[model samples]
Target chain A: MDTEEIYREMANSIVSLDQEKAVHLANQALDESMDLLQVIEKGFGEGIRKVGDLWDEGEFFLPELMSGAQIMEKAVDIITPGLQSSGSERQSSGKVLLATIEGDIHSIGKTIVATMLKANGFQVVDLGTDVKAEKIVDEAIKGDIDIIGVSTLLTTTMVNQKKVIDLLNQKNIRNKFKVIFGGAPVTQGWVDECGADGYAENAVESVKLVKELIQ
Target chain B: MLFTNWLEDKSKIILFDGAMGTQLMNRDLEPGKIPDLLNIENPEVVKKVLASYYDAGSDMVQTCTFSSNVVSLNRHNISNLYQKINVEAINNIKAILPSEENLIVGDIGPSGEFRPPVGNASGDMWKAGFQKQAKILAPGIDLWHIETISDLQEMSAAIQGIKEVSEKPIIASMTYRKTKTRGFFTIMGDSVETCVTKLEEEKVDVIGTNCTLGSDQMIELIKELVNLTDIPISAKPNAGQPRLSGGNTLYDQPVEDYVNDIGQMIDLGVKIVGGCCGTTPTHIRKIRTLIDSR
Candidate 1:
């Protein structure tokens, strides 16, 4: 197949969540001496971007986004070594620390955000769920992170999102990192109340919000 | 026990309790710890919370075991406390009730892991996790109540697992978000009609929406559900949509407003009415008064 056809197949494989086809295309591209970064950017990248768009439009749900993410991650895993060996520039937008705030165990929202951020060239350190504010702040400072994203599904746990910011201020280093919050219960009012830098309603907006915050 | 049997009759509306996590937070629950773990470590605390709900005239009180499933417990690295937590949670609720007639729902929440081909967790894993919790809590519980489930696939797996351990009636509820185009659908994309149809097909004793939308929005969703099935419908809406005020997440619906909204639910043939997030005992008390007045 021509390069354009191969890229189209790769993108289609991700959109369809056909992991085997995605991997086979990645391997075929490599064997044909296709540029690995081009495969990642145009193939896996375009596919996931479309998946994100579908998700934004509510045409896709968590299962489809997650499946698509896994497929992209798989293809990226196969291509990363080649890009590294060829000394291609694999620039990251920034590092983000993501977690579901303390007292909340819901992780799907945060996981989706993590997946999307990773796909968009952001380094994400996921702290799972029910994470304490102090721990989140400590990691932000220690890891030199650019952004901290807190997620909480429970109304009660939403306070902990602010607690992370409070801890950062108490440490007198609040200006060091941008803080973003999201979840079912979160609103723009909560973002302001918590003194968070930004808020995203969903995974797609999360990437955009992070980009805006960093810029 | 009389009320427990009557719940199956579906001749009258049943009143389930309001939010447990918020009530516990009021009782000084440390934020990061698993609330279910409180059952094993502080049964008195768990018992006190259950007692308040029962005192508020909740005919049925759910155990403090919402997140006790293996997947969630393991996430906190406390999987070994799973059986103890579920067993103690029921025991604590049982200890508080004045009579065995008062139903104790073995509450189950989502496993916090998406089932494949979306995530790594398989259907077998979802079934196993829920089954493990069900078996442990089966001895003291009168029925199973799965609440705040967003995914239909996960809900199906949970019900299947719970059925393997007990023949008790299961009340399966999904949390839904209102979409402009679809009307009302779960975050996982199960619409009100779709979810009700699926839950009915699964033969769950009760089916409805809970957690995300408030009673106002829920009344409309419940109306849609009531149209789809003859099965008794339940509505456990949040007090209202959440708002941020002074760093606190506050639900805008007051007890009167909530009770008022729920009155419409009752009018529309909803058989089971309760509160989800942001609801308090006062809300439950008001609901009781409404039921009594009716």
Candidate 2:
């Protein structure tokens, strides 16, 4: 099958949450020995975007979306290095640090965004859950990350998202690292209230929003 | 009329607590993560809360071990220390008894991971997860409370594993997303009657719903459930509904509102009753006083 067909098939495996099938199709695409970049850009990236569309249309739930991202991440784990050596050259989008804010330990959403960003050619530093605001800013400053995305699944922890964003401005790093927020409790109103750079409904959109801002 | 010898001679549906996460929050636990760990990590706080339920109206205070399973423990980077933490958790609760006939229940909650048919989680993986905790807790607890269960497939497997580990009465509660709008079905579109039937088929000692929604929703489901099985029913709902404020998770339900309803549960023929999310000793105190008055 063509690389395009392979990518679509791979995307479907992700949607189906079929890790083995995803890996199988990705390996078949690899055997064709086609341009890995074309496979990733046309195949994986587009595949996940399609998955994102499913989420937007309400055809998919949180588990489905997260599984798709996991599939994509596993596939990338196998293919990214190969593409890097092929000379098509992966994009070196700036490094981004992401986490679920304090009082909220749910990381399924944040993990999805990290997976998508890495697939889309951005270096992402993930700090996991219940991350304090100071820890987030310190990482951003030390790493000089291009953007910091904060996730909060609970309302109690949502304030920490704002706290981290506010701390960013307080430390005069607001301009240095763009701040974004997302998660169940995080809303557009929250974004506006916290003076955040942007907010997305899911990890895929968060990746898109970050890419747009940095570009 | 599910038959449970909870008190040896008491013949009635069992009542469980409502909104533990909701209750703990009122006791000062921020939402997200394993708030149940307060049982060991802060037993003084946990003891005060559980003891209050005994004073208020609880025949049993479930030991804090809802997320004691390895899967939930892994969330707090305690996966490597699951055996140690879970054992300590149960031991701590057992240490501070009410000096009454009250029992200690070991709570087992969902793993939050997908299982076969929906996801790739293996039965062995799941059985291992529950067994690891149950084995450690069963010897200590008066009974094992398996709740917030979503998968029907794992219900029997969990019960069988627990039976292998302990002869303690295992009260199995499923977390169905019941609503007045959609009576007796879960968020995954499971019917309460069907779930209860499945649990009954497994012959679980006690069966009912916990987490998701509140007392009113649970009451609605029980209206259907109590009639379905002659077995005693269990209902542990949330603190009404969690409200998001200032980015912090809050349970806005009042204690009197909760206490005022224990009679309703009893009137509906509920045998056992306690609080879950928004419940504290104060709420249990009211429930106890109300029950005594009856």
Candidate 3:
């Protein structure tokens, strides 16, 4: 197949959530001496972007969205080493620290955001769920992260997202990183009320919000 | 005390209690502390929340074991305390009940773990997690209530797990978001028809929707549910969409307004009703007045 044909098949593989096909295409592209970064950006990345659009349009749901992300991740795994061994690494958009704020054990929303952010070229450090504000802020400082994404699916735990921002300001380093809020209960108004930099309603929007914040 | 015949009085509407997480916060639960731990560490608080609901005329109040299931507890490194948490959660409610006439729902929330294609967890994993909790909670509680679940697969596993342990009446509720496409759907993309079909196939005593949508939004969804299922329907919508005020999350839907919306739900033939996130005893009190006056 031609280079463009291979890329189309790769994109289709993710759009269909066909992981085996995506992996096969990734390997085929490498064997044909294709540019690995192009395989990712034009092929798998294009597919994930389409999946995100379908998610936004309500044509896709959480399972489809997460499955698409997982497929993209697997395809990228097959392609990344080729780029690295060839010393042609793709530039990351920015680094983000993601967590489900403390007191909330819900992690699906946060995990979807992490997967989408990673698929969209952001380096993500997931702190997992029930993370304390101190630990979140401490990691933000330690990692020199560009953005902190705090999420809580429970209404009661929503306060801890604000707590993370408060801890940052208490340390007098609020300006050092952009803080974005997410989860079912978070709103744009809540983000503003809590002094957060931004809020995204879902995983698809999280990528766009994180990108705009870093910019 | 499986009250398998609990719904025999078709004329009387069964009232479930309001939100546990909301009451816990009002009682000064810290931002990061696990709510389930309160069962073992602070039984009084859990009892107080249930007592207020009972006083407000809730015929049935759920135990504070929503997040004590193995999968969720494991995330907090308290998986070993799962059985203990479930036991104490039921004990706390039993201690405060005014009489045996009032029902105690053994509340179960989602496992927070997803199955295949989307997540690594399997149906068996979900079944095991729920079964473990059900075994501990079934002995004390009168019935089982599984709520706020998004995936039908998980719901099926929950039903199987609970049924494996006891013959309690199961109230299966899934949380849904109102879509712009003229219907309500769970976040997992299960449509109302799909939800109704699954719950019916599982032979649950109650089929309903809860969380995400407010009472106003729930009116339409409950209307749809009433049309689809002959089984008793439950509507436990959020007080409304939560809004942040002064750095604390609050549900701005007023008690009168919330009860009014619930009234519409009752008119549409909803049998089991209560609040979800952000509801308190005040909302339940008004609902009690509405039910009695009706």
Candidate 4:
């Protein structure tokens, strides 16, 4: 197949959520001596972008989004060695640290956001669930993160999102990284009240929010 | 048998208590604290909530065990209290129950653990946790009420778990979100038709929808649910969508608006109706007035 055809196939694999097809295409692109970076950005990257659009349009749901991310991650894994051996690196748009605040064990939403951010060219460090505000702020500072995304599904736990911001401000480094809050119960009003940079309703909007804040 | 008798009259409306969590919040249950722990920490407070629902004219009241299952307790570092929490949740309600005429539903919420590709939580884990809760709660509860689950697999697991422990009638409710492209679906993409088909296969006594959507959207979902199954339908929609203000989450849907939409749900042939998040005893009282007038 032509290079353009190969890119289309790679994109299609992700949209269809076929991990095997995506991995096969990634290996094929490498065997054909294709530019690894282009395959990732133009091929798999375009596919994830489409997934995000589909999600926003309400044609896709959380399972589809999570599955698509898993597929994209697998394809990217297959192509990573090739890029390394060629003395090249895939440039990330920014680094984001993610967590589900203290007293909340909800993980699905936060994990989807991490994967979606990865697909959109952002490096993500996910601290998993029930994370304390102190630990979250400390990790952001330690990681030199560009953005901090805090998620919570419970109203009781959402207050921790504000605590993270309060802790950041207390440290006098609140402006060093953009902080975005998300979860089922989050809203723009809450974001404003908590002094967060933005609030996203779901994983797809999370990617857009990060992009806007980072820029 | 009691459950069957309550539903014997096809035209009679079955009224359930409104939100347990919402009532607890009103009672100054600390935010972020595990609500189920109240059963152990302060049984009186839990009993008071159940008594209020009965006073509000609810035919059925749910136990405060929505999060008392093994999986959720483990998440909160209270795994040791699993059996105790489930037992107390039922006994606390049973203590203040006005009479046998008022049914006690064994409230079961989601595992807060997703199954399969969504996460690593296996179906067996879900089944085991649900079975344990049901086993402890079976004797005291009039029926099994599993609500707010978005995943079909998890819902199936819960049914199988409860079945393993008891023969009580089961009411399985899934939460749905209104989509822009497709009509309505669980966050995991289980459509109403799919849910009905699966719940039927399990021979569940009732198929229902609760949480995520407000009373108005629930009216739309009930229309779809009633068309898909012969099983009795139950709906427990939230007061409305949660909004954030002044560091608190509020469900600002007016009681008049909520009760009016509920009136529409009753007209749609919904056999069992109640409230989910943000709903109060006042809402249940209003629903009682609506159902009694019929």
Candidate 5:
């Protein structure tokens, strides 16, 4: 198959959740000396964006979206180093530190945001779920992150999102990094109340919000 | 007699307890630690929460085993205490029940592992984790309450697991989101119609939505469900939409407002009603009063 057909097939494999086919196509692209950036943008990136669109339209569900993300992650892992070594221009967006605040174990929403942000060129440092405010602040300081995104799925844990901001303020570094809050229980009102810089209801909007913040 | 039989004999709606994790947190259960651990290490704290529900006129109280499955427990590095966590949670709730008539539900929640082609967890893993907890808690509990589930596949796997261990009736509930399109659907995109059809197929004794939406949204969802299923429908909405205030997530619905919504749920023929996140004994007491008046 030509490069275009191979890219199309790779995109189809991700949407179909065909992990093997996605991997095979990714490898085929690599072996055929396809432009690594073209493969990423046209194949894996296009595939995940389609999945996101389906999710937005309610035609695809969490499982399908997650599987597509997994496939994209795998293909990207295979292509990223090759692209870098080939001297392709690396698009560096702002760095983001993400976590599900302490007391909450809900990671799916935060994970989706991380995937979407990565797809949109943001460098995300995910601290995983049940992350403490102190740890989030410490990571932000250490990583020189531009944004700290905290999520909570439980009402009981929503306070922790604020606590992270509080800790940042206590350290006198709150102004240095923008903070975004999200999850099922979080609202725009909560984002303002928690002193977060922004809020996104879903992953797609999250990427947009991050872009706007950085810009 | 079975709990389902007893439920049928009662003419009134059954009231389940609300918000165990939040109640426990209020009682000083530390953040980020497993709440189920309290069942084994601090039965008094667990008992206190259950006792409050019982005092609030809850006909049934769920054990603090919502996250006791091996998959969830393993995340907390306490998978070794999985059996003890579930069994003790049931035992603590059973201890606090005023009588045998008061039910102790074996609470099973999401496994925290997504089943493949999305995540690494297999169907067998989900089933085994649920079955392990069910097997341990089934003896002490009156029935199984699988709740806060978002995925249909996981919900089906849980039902199959519970059925494998016991003939007890299962109350299966999924947490749904009100889509931008104004349609009721689970986080995984399972519509109310889809959930009702599938839950009925799985032979769940009761089916409904829980956790995500508040009682107002739940009333609308229950209306949709009432049209589809002949089985008992439960509605365990949050106290209200959560709003952050002074760094705390507060559910703003007044007790009266919550009970009023429950009244609407009852008017629409919802047989089982209770609270999910942000609900307290106050909410349950109000609901009890509403149900009693009816």
Candidate 6:
């Protein structure tokens, strides 16, 4: 297959959740001497974006979204090391830390945001869920992270986003990194209440928000 | 004495629990806030409500600890206060009644998320949360009511925790959302047959249903459930569907309307019948009156 054809096959495989086919097509696309970024942009990114669109439009539900995301993750796993090992001059993006706040166990939303950001060339360090506020700030300080993304599904737990922000300010780390928040009960009002720099309604918007925050 | 044992030998039908959340909301619970916090911060209000439920003929009263899990508490900025929160939750429930016979079911509720390792809540975290809450609650509780559990993953975690410490009979129940306006499936898509088979392995003393659709819906689900297992079934349904009126949640079906439907749940082999969302002492009294006469 041609480069574009190979990339399209990889995208279809990921969307279809045929991990082996996705792996094969991605490897073929890479072997065809396609640009690494071009392969990722055409294949995994578009596949995940299509899955997200289907989810938003109710054509796909949670299980399908999960399967599609998992496929994209599998594809990325193989492609990432090749791209990194090649030492090619690539896009310059921002650094970000994302986590589901401590006491909240819902991490899927945060995972989606991190995946999309990473696919778009942002440096996203996923802290995982039930994360302590100190650990978040500590990571930011240690890694010199540019953005902190906190996710919480419960209305009561969303307060942790504010708590993390409060500790950052208390520890004299507020101005170090921009904070963005999202999840089920996280509103635009909550963004102001938590004193976060930005908020995204969904994963697709999170990339735009992170880019804007860094710029 | 086991409520189920007492229930099995007795000729009279059971007087199940009452509308815990609705009664709790009436006592000034904010939306999405842990209602069990009232048990600690304002014991008198919780006392009045429970006493009212008992007086209203509710033989069984669940403690105000549905959202008392550490995961849910941290949501409300009570992360460092897990022990205090649960201790107060138990003590407040103890303060409401004088004796062990009046069974205060320690409510071991869900974390509102998928189970861990694959999800965010690690099995260790879930166990730790349950252990901390149960350590304080087990001493005061006559029975540990693992109520409103939706998924098998969480139920397994909670059961594993309870068996580690307390020997109290744990009553496991789940909430089912009606897919077709009275479907026999849980919110997570587990059917009543699946629930019965899985719950049997967990070794819960009393297995049942609670906190979903109204009496009619509960009856439909229960009837479907009867074909699945011979396990002692408990049914505590909502008074009716929730409706938004004047910016407040209201169940259009009154106490009598709910009590009127109790017979159907009973006919479906519901061993224990009570109210859930819209129930109060008044509804329980009517239920008691209805059950006693039958």
User: Judged by lDDT, which candidate is best?
Assistant: 4
What's the true lDDT of residue B269 in model 3?
90
Q: Model 6: which docking level applies? A: incorrect
Q: iRMSD per model?
A: 2.5, 6.1, 2.2, 1.8, 2.6, 8.1
Candidate 2 - chain A - TM: 0.84
Candidate 6 per-residue lDDT over residues B103-137, each given as its tens digit: 78888888755542124666667777777778878
Candidate 3 lDDT over residue span B51-158, tens digit each? 999999999999999888898788778899997898888889989998877998999998878876556788998999999999999988888889999999999999
Which parts of model 1 are misplaced by more than 4 Å?
A1-9, A28-39, A81-87, A100-107, A127-144, A153-157, A170-173, B1-11, B99-101, B244-249
Winning model by DockQ: 4
TM of each candidate vs. truth: 0.88, 0.71, 0.93, 0.97, 0.88, 0.67
lDDT accuracy of residue B91 in candidate 1? 78
Q: Model 6 Cα displacement at B150 (Å)?
A: 2.3
Ranking 2 against 4 by TM-score, winner: 4
lDDT of 4 by residue, B1-294 (tens): 778987778778999989888678767778678789999998888888889889999999999999888987887888889988987887788788898788999999998887656777888999998888889999998898999999999999999999988999999999999888789988888889999999999999989889999998888888888888889999999988887666666888899999999999989888898999998889999999988888
Query: Each prediction's Cα lDDT score?
Result: 0.84, 0.70, 0.88, 0.88, 0.84, 0.74
Q: Which ten residues in a row have the lowest lDDT in candidate 1 chain B?
A: B1-10
DockQ of each: 0.47, 0.18, 0.56, 0.69, 0.50, 0.08
The digit string of per-residue lDDT tens for model 1 on B238-258 reads 888778686455677668989
- Model 6: colliding residue pairs: A156-B75, A157-B75
Candidate 2 lDDT, tens digit per residue, B228-294? 8877666666657654556455566887776665567677766667666555566666666676666
Question: lDDT, candidate 6, residue B61?
Answer: 83
**Model 3 stretches with alpha carbons more than 4 Å out:** A85-87, A132-135, A170-172, B1-6
Per-residue lDDT of candidate 3, residues A1-215 (tens digit): 78888888988999999988999998987898798888889999999999999888777898899899988988888888888889998789999999888878787788889999898888999999888999999999999999999989767778778888889889999999999998887888888888899999889988988888898
